[model samples]
Target: MTEIETRVLRPDAAGIAEAARLLGAGALVSFPTETVYGLGGDARDSVAVARIFDAKGRPHFNPLIVHVPDLDAARRFADISGPVEALAKHFWPGPLTLVAPLAEGHGLSPLVTAGLDTVALRVPAHPAAQDVLRVFDGPVAAPSANPSGRISPTTAAHVLAGLAGKVDAVLDAGPCPVGLESTIVGGTPLALLRPGGLAQEDIERVVGPLKTAGDTITAPGQLASHYAPNAAIRLNANAAHPGEVLLGFGPMQSDLNLSVTGDLIEAAAHLFDHLHTLDAMDRPIAVAPIPNCGLGRAINDRLRRAAAPRT
Candidate 1:
């Protein structure tokens, strides 16, 4: 594992300045987002962005999202049209991502775009993230702060566990409230690039209906096999397969049941953490199919990817 300098940040000017300095120096800074901790760097710095891909072993073909201080700053990377602008105004500072054409002279590094014309942008609601971006002058190219093809980090420990020696710093902001990736909406007719902390219906209510992308999605988190753990995962009720371990959502249990709460929020909160634990259990894993609604949709999306036939 690559060794990285890790620092804990408090909500103070000193902490913000330290984080800004690390980013300015082209080092990867993993910080809290309302959705998940993000492994980020200066979006305009090709060298810095390359460091992120190298740190996470993230594929060059898969794009990254730009985290801005606010909607105004977000507009710098992408041209915000009427509908995109409306959604950003209403749902930004929350778990919503808008993909739009890059603005002229946006100066975003090509590595961040993976050669795509569009850029994925979001204004996270996490206070630590907001403050860091606010004090910093440049855009942060961030993806979920974890190893590529693994479960995303929802808490600082998750970052420390997977990225402790892989990045420069980590801003612990307690357990992520949303505990999932942001809802990415883009493409023609405005589709859901990835299901996440936000629901598809909530997005439609504000921006009208959205088209859900197919299995081979172009945006981040759309790959058929992603957000996986070390151990094999079986989705639906397929835990009974020989040698398979289990992660049940409600009453079911093959190895560990998330809970009897039957609440998607509760399940989402435990999802990745449980997957991590199951990996530690050193066995095959199985997860109950969560309902396809709200965060459940996002959770199931990850589970499906995890359970897909591994290469």
Candidate 2:
């Protein structure tokens, strides 16, 4: 494992140049995307893409999502048809990932797609990420910057905690704004591959209703025992359980309630960070069930996946 060095990028020439150089050299760099801190590398380089998998111990079968500068860049990676174009036009530069069939002549390495016929791509809305992308001439393939099946990183420190000695550099762009993964929609009739910062209703509003895939997954962010903390997260409600570290929504911190006052968005932002904290304490954890709507749906999905049986 290589020690990962993180630099707070100055808003000047030197910082951007350094970042571009590291990325161009096939080194892994963690950067802020609107959705979360993504462990990024040149999308066209299979060696760099494979390093992302090796560093995180990610399974080869779970595909990575490519982060592009804009819709035009995305077109170079995947074949965007009418509906896909429409959705990108309206909701892109935000937290939406479209899984379109990879163009036969696409330039992105097959490893980024996990040898699949399709690829997941997004153009983030974060200004910091946009600046970084603009400085670089190519798209980047990045997954959540954490170890495979563990909690994803929303802050640069979180990336350091998990991958400090495993990667080359981390561009400290600060905390992620949306603080979750992008919603992945794929295939005919357009199914939800992963619930994320973007809500289902919002996607449906622009692209029509989406067919939802099952909880089990074969790609990034889809594992049953994923997004887990070292501490056991038991899914309970406001109801208390003995010897359990409980997470409550706004004001509900009976024993670390995650915003016990019931602000779903707050809970969403704090979810992984809190889990990592508690897991560090090595205590047993229980999470109160939240309403399965809007961000709640993404929240609950993460909790369910976290509690999935770990072999």
Candidate 3:
């Protein structure tokens, strides 16, 4: 395959318009969202959606999230039920995704859904994302802008590091604020598919208690081993082993600190960037124990998956 020159576009009016034109013409574009950078393509175009999976080496069975400008646009592609509507009203423009039954006659490519009957939908809070979606006026199927289960990219530099010559363009809008993927809520009996930037307790407060999904890969981030770095990762370590780089949280002396103040929110924003840093050091990575509370739960979830023995 011939290499595509990836343009680094600013998140401005002209940049948004050009990015939208690329998507409309079935080219892959990586753009920033509140959670993480997403490798996006026109969801309605099977060929374009196929490029996304091919570029990332993503599995066909692992579905992609369709990001729209607003809830109304989301309803055009997904059968948003009452519960999903309630959740959207509260969290549409943030780090939350709702998987609902695919609406009848929805024109999304089967590749985007991975042949599943449900469609994952999100309205990202990032200004660049909103601008791209609005100008494109269609659903863009996006997954973390990395080589499929690798560390999610939180900045344009990270996206280019993994996919610079692989994708068409990347809209640089600075570092992602959330720095984690969106929390995915789906399935009957209402279970949490993935823990992410949005806390599980907050979701439970909005809806009732949510059953955690079992080992089934019903949504993104369900794979037992994902979000990995090149270096081996050791979780919940008090200190780094010899020749290992230490990633610490909450006032711990280490090679790099997620947050010196022990703030989970702050730690969440720094997670992937720190992982990228440690991975580049070409040393084994050790992480100080993070408390399993609020955003820490999501942080630990990513760490555990990152530390899981790669297949």
Best by lDDT: 3
Which TM-score value belongs to model 1? 0.94
lDDT string for model 2 (168-266, tens) is 777786777667788888778778888888889988998788887875453468777788887777886675577777777656556665566687777
The digit string of per-residue lDDT tens for model 3 on 196-230 reads: 99999999998889997998677888888899999
lDDT of 3 at 31: 98
Better candidate by lDDT, 1 or 2: 1
In candidate 1, the residue pairs with backbone N, CA or C atoms under 3 Å apart (3 or more residues apart, or in different chains) clash, namely 4-165, 245-284, 245-286, 247-286
lDDT of each: 0.84, 0.82, 0.93
- What lDDT score goes with residue 268 in model 2? 76
TM-score winner between 2 and 3, please give it.
Answer: 3
Error of 3 at 133 (Å): 0.3
Which residues of candidate 1, in runs, are more than 4 Å off? 214-217, 238-244, 252-255
Question: Which residues of candidate 2, in runs, are more than 4 Å off?
Answer: 1-13, 214-219
- TM-score of each candidate? 0.94, 0.94, 0.99
What's each prediction's clash count? 4, 14, 0
